[model samples]
Target: MTTRHPNAGLERLHRETGWTLRQLAQEINRLGTERGTPVAYQKPSVHQWLNGQLPKESVRPLIIEAFSRKLLRPVTYGEAGFPEPAEESKNPPATVEGLMELGRQDMDPSRRSVLGAGLFSVALTVPGWQDVVGRMEAIKQNPKLRIGQAEVRAVLAMTERLSDLDDDFGGRYARPMAAAFLVNTVSPYLKAESSSETRNSMLSAAAFLCYLTGWMAVDEGAHGRAQQYYVRALELAGASGDHNTYCHVLRGMSVQAANLGHGAPAVRLANAAAEAAPESTPRMRAFMAGQQAHAYALAGERTNARTALREAERAVNQAESQLGTFGGFSSATLAYSTAEVRYALGDTLGSIQSLQDHFRLRDSTDMQRSKLIFSSLLAERQLQVGHLEEACATWNSVLDEYPAIHSGRIDEQMAKIASLLSSYQRNPIARQTSERSRELCLK
Candidate 1:
């Protein structure tokens, strides 16, 4: 996804650091071995990375990981000449699952083997990906408009599209297209201007990307990497001077932290999000408060958690009232976020009821698959309370759709369903459901 010449800074940095690609790779190998996460690097592959040439997209993260470990401080993508968001909102709708798809594809060592995998967003509404590439080429032709804020915004919008929509109606086609526009076209924009506003907006964009990447790490059970990303994202959000975006990133961090059982920081982070973004649009406010409730629930502060949930509900109601006549997410996404908290807090009934309310507000098919995960999680809570027959039935009902939706979030939910059914795998109905889930869902 890097757009600058593959060796954007390779030639400069490799010499300055006095480390050959092979030397760095060896250091990486040694570091990983010492840490007990040994990685084998091909010498030729190391040479290719040094000279850029894209260095195989699969090796991008390895390079990042190796450098981050060596630096002993955070090494943001922007600093590495990797494409960073220069303009756009940080929280793309499919941000959670999209990054995992990125990492999954990156697992392959072969360049072509790493197919287009991480794509979602409404940004695909743009013209063809080739059109975008052409546009980037044209930017090179124009001296005045090349780095203009308008062009930067255009690129940011395209990135958003790649992370939102999941219509099997060719979503894979959109991934590389958007990545191309960002890397080849937009990344140069980051270097165009270091003006205060541009810098702030770029930071906001970078933070959002971090949030997406962190969310992906969470799906893979990589807790420490996920936490580090969240912390850096939070800092970037602060640097951007945007309370709304910062809160959103923090809200995401709360979910990750809570899922990893870091109850206290989770609670604190979500609470700060809610507090700082108090004047945010009603939907945004609900998202923050919902995050607060989730963190409190994980912390076992039932009384406080319940109160925050009520506040979240109040925020949702206020949001709906304001957008009473309209059907658009800019107003309704907060309630969907709130529903997720309901499930997180063990409110299965509430989650189901809220989701039912949300079923009609969508303009994208991506939410259809998302709704299934919410339903599955609700069933999980049902099983927790001894509603085995209903839970088995509920999990089975959605099994029909599981195989087709490859989002990693669905993977986690399916794994949970599988675990829940394990207790009753011997039962006839349970056996059928477990096999269906395993056979259909575990890719």
Candidate 2:
């Protein structure tokens, strides 16, 4: 029933290993077991691969190892008939290659390699910042490809547009296009020769894209892929000596950790980000401190949460007074932090008030995802306080935006709201709203 094509590359590699198909399969299976994922890949499976069948992405790493051990040399995934992963290194060219590979894989929605390898190791999140930072390389005087200011400017422009799209439409709409641009356009520039200035600019641009890609991955519910992107982005940021972007990437990691309920680790990452930020920007300081506040709240450290919240507010006020530039540290940023702090302290009314302030301060043209999230939280809080009519009303606001955006986080929120409303199914308003929420989820 299967069409077979000659996989000459794989057949050639197997021949070089001096092992028959059976022996190779045995070695692969052993490696898989050692890695705690037992696989029974047999000789037939090896034959099938040689006949052009691709194994699961997770199995590719094990196969690479099997070839490495048998061949007595470092075997890349490509050498073992698998696609290359996003590679990282102190070397800029190598890092670019990794980013390109990531982009290439992401461009194909059907490819499960990156998405399926969702290995979120909370253990690996710690213990690399110092080494990574220390190993940051200086901009190369001579790059492989000749790059110029024009190319760099183009990449930056694309990044800005993609960022805006991400804010408005969520990651699902823009992530594939971003991935394509990174690989098809940006990677070539990174691979080309360039002057030191051009190289630094290019590295910074690539780093920004990587960070955005990771954030998009988070929105896609692919936490493992997001972690990989964050780590590589941090490396690129450090190598470019871009402290501001470096701190931002760290803050992203902290946010992801907090979302995963590893509150202590999240707080630690946020603290590190705050420590690493440029002193000239109070807005950055406030954002990092606010992240720490949110992490503390997640950890149920009421005192620490309040303390960090106060610090965040003070820094935000200072930033505003001094006219510091804003990125993610806009007015909505502070209000969101305040809401988290208040909710942690059991001040439901205060939390609601802060959330309303967030809505008032956030630009209407900004990301609809944020609006959906804030509205969902507001409705949940209102429902909790026995304000049934207001809760239903608040949820209706979310429905207004729900059909327009595609976000895993938003979908999860809608599902939660639907589940909560089930208890109120006897009420006509609750039943109607619950049905609408379910319809959105199905879509």
Candidate 3:
């Protein structure tokens, strides 16, 4: 008879979770449902796995994610006594090739669900500027294939169009198109022979596109997939030696972490971004500081958060115009950031006031998708403050625009409307709003 050894690594992680076998199994099953692959695992199944029985291949990621969530850190396959997934390579591919592969996967509808199921890792290794600067892999030039400033300009223009689309609609419909563009059009441009200046411009443009794609993924609630795109953006920005874009991508990563409620990582990424661009313009300063304020608040650093908010206010005050602003950082954007910081710091009333200010400062050019998101947030806060009528009215406004947009984030917000108003169904407006929300969700 063969002796089967216990999985010491898995056993160690299980102990760290402080969960009973039943609890561990339940958590894994819960995560499976979240990933759209429901499973029914019991204590016996978990016990069997710990006692030298390997889990099915498909269940391994769920186990890893469950531990990562419970322990508030990433748990690798090896750390959990599982073999690495076959698709993961020990030797990372060159930047362009890796980007192509990622884009292709994103473009394929059949692969998207599986790709989106990737777990967001709190302990992801982010490469610093020094590590990736000017590190693009050498490519064999095809003498006939040459790109110049015009090609770079075209890419930038295309990206701008995509951004407008994302703003008007949502990322759910726009992201596939972006992935296709990255794979079919942008990838070739990256490999084409060009002058150093033109090449750098193309790289910077591509990095921005990647950042936008990641931003869209976040809107779709595909956080893990979003992080992958963000990392690629950072790598490309660093490779091009574009300090501004590199800092911008870092700030974006901070936003992702903050949205996911990973406060420490958010603060770290925000600080890194600000530190990298000490000599940035006033608008850029406001952009970075506002995010820092929100992150610090999320991390429970009230003093630092207040100081950063004040700095952001001053920087925005000093800026002459919003023309060519990085990420459209304006007074309105500052107001929104203020709202975020206030909410994170437990000032619900102050956050609501700030959000109102955000809407007031908006122009006709503001993205409809943003308007919907902010409106939903305002309504949720209104309900929190015991203003049932006001909240319903605000939510009604959101529902007015809800049908036209396709966003996972918006869908999540819509999903909350019914549950939030369910208790107040005796109130006519609340009941009406709940019914409407349910109707929309069904569609």
Query: What lDDT does the true structure give each of the candidates?
Result: 0.55, 0.77, 0.90
By TM-score, is 1 or 3 better? Answer: 3
Rank candidates, TM-score, best first.
Answer: 3, 2, 1
Model 3 reaches what TM-score against the true structure? 0.93
Q: After superposition, how far is residue 346 of candidate 2 from its true place, in Å?
A: 3.7
- After superposition, candidate 3 runs with Cα above 4 Å error: 1-3
lDDT of 3 by residue, 1-443 (tens): 11189989999999998999999999888877766678999999999899878899889888987887778677899998888998764788788888898898889766767777766666778898898889888977667789999999999999999998999889987999999999999989998889999999999999999999999989888888898899899889988898888898889899988987878789989999999974678898899999999999998999999999999999999999998777678989999999999999999999999999999999998899999999999999999999999999999999998999989899999999999998999999999999999999999
Candidate 1 stretches with Cα past 4 Å from truth are 1-146, 165-186, 194-203, 220-223, 227-232, 235-239, 278-281, 320-366, 416-419, 423-427, 441-443
Please name the candidate that would achieve the greatest TM-score relative to the true structure.
3
lDDT of 2 by residue, 1-443 (tens): 23367566788888898898889999888866545467898888988888888787778777776665555455666665566665422343556667777788789877633354464445444334465553643334334458799999999999989988887788877888888998888877766777778877887888898899889888777777787788778877766667777888888898887876666667778888878777546776788889999988877888888788888888778765434364557667799888877886688988999998998888765577878888899999989988887899999888888888877677778889788988899999998888988887887
Candidate 1 per-residue lDDT over residues 1-443, each given as its tens digit = 32334665655545555676678878656644433356787677666654555554444545555565444334455555555534332753232233333334434324422232221110112112122111211112233533445654764575466555443312233333433443444444544545666655765675565555455445444445455456555655555565555567667766766765556667866776666663556666566666677778767787777787777677667775544322122324545555656666667677665665565564564455556766676577677767788778778767767666645556668876667677797788888888887877645
Q: TM-score, each model? A: 0.57, 0.75, 0.93
Tell me how candidate 3 scores on lDDT.
0.90
Cα-based lDDT at residue 434, candidate 2: 88
Q: Considering summed lDDT, which 10 consecutive residues are worst modelled in model 1? A: 119-128
Candidate that would win on lDDT:
3
